[model samples]
Target: MVDVSAITYDALRVAAEHVLAKVREGEELGTEDIFILYLGTIVNELRDVRSEVARLEDKIDKTSQRIDETNKRIDELAKSLSARIDDTNKRMDETAKSLSARIDETNKRIDETNRRIDEVVKSLSARVDDLAKRIDALQTTLLEIQKLLIELVRSRQ
Candidate 1:
């Protein structure tokens, strides 16, 4: 009727080109979807990393507080121990003084006892000398009586 074969061929060629263009557009859309997915994944990772960092920072702060508390406790304990040691030293000093006084008193008593012993020894030595002198006098009187008896006997013979 109006050259139907040429018109049909031209229409088929146009439809084929439209199909190819649509396929290309679909490929581009697929690539854009993949890119968006990748960007979302990166954003999620960054958020997770930030959350982890915040948690770590909180933990560090808590640890620092705990360390400070421990140090304060240690300081308090050291001060308490030092006070106790000072009290003990004071008591020890008093005890040492008491012991020294007792030792000094003991030494004084010992010196007094020695003096008494020396006095007693001098009295005994004097008594011993008086007894020796009396013994010598009695021996001399016995010898004189013996000599008188011998003279009387000779006169009678």
Candidate 2:
């Protein structure tokens, strides 16, 4: 009878192999040998389960590593995009400042042009007034000469 107590997996495997060899030699297998064979089958199935579990763990580790790498790439892209946006904003601000300065310069030129136009208008108006006064004086002198000529002609008649 095989000692069931304190039987390690290696001892059980050796006993099972011995029993298989005896059975192949046409020797009758006792009940204890059959039981050892059954236990060996259970141990082998457990080993296969452990191997499958390890394989799955390795695959999961690889997937996790890939996920971490992808996250890092996303972070880098975000940083690059943020920097580009900041640069664009800075350029826009500079352009706005330049345009404001140009607008101010244009307004100053417009103000100067208006002042010159006003001066020219005033000068022309003063000259027109002086000419009108001279024309009135000439009309009055002509009327007085006409009256003196009529008086002289009447005295001679």
Off by over 4 Å in 2: 1-8, 11-42, 132-157
The digit string of per-residue lDDT tens for model 1 on 2-94 reads 998567556655554555576667754456455554555565687699899999999999999999999999999999999999999999999
Q: Give the count of colliding residue pairs in each prediction.
A: 0, 0
Show where candidate 1 strays beyond 4 Å: 1-39, 143-157
Q: What are the C-alpha RMSDs, in order, of all predicted structures? A: 16.9, 5.6
| lDDT against true structure, model 2 | 0.91
Q: Compute the lDDT for candidate 1.
A: 0.81
Q: Write the per-residue lDDT of candidate 2 for residues 1-157, one digit (tens) a residue.
A: 8766446876887898899999899998888988988888998898899899999999999999999999999999999999999999999999999999999999999999999999998998998888888888888888888888899899799
Best-fitting candidate, scored by TM-score: 1
Point to the candidate with the largest lDDT: 2
Per-candidate local distance difference test: 0.81, 0.91
* Count of backbone collisions within predicted model 2: 0
Worst 10 residues of 1 by lDDT: 28-37
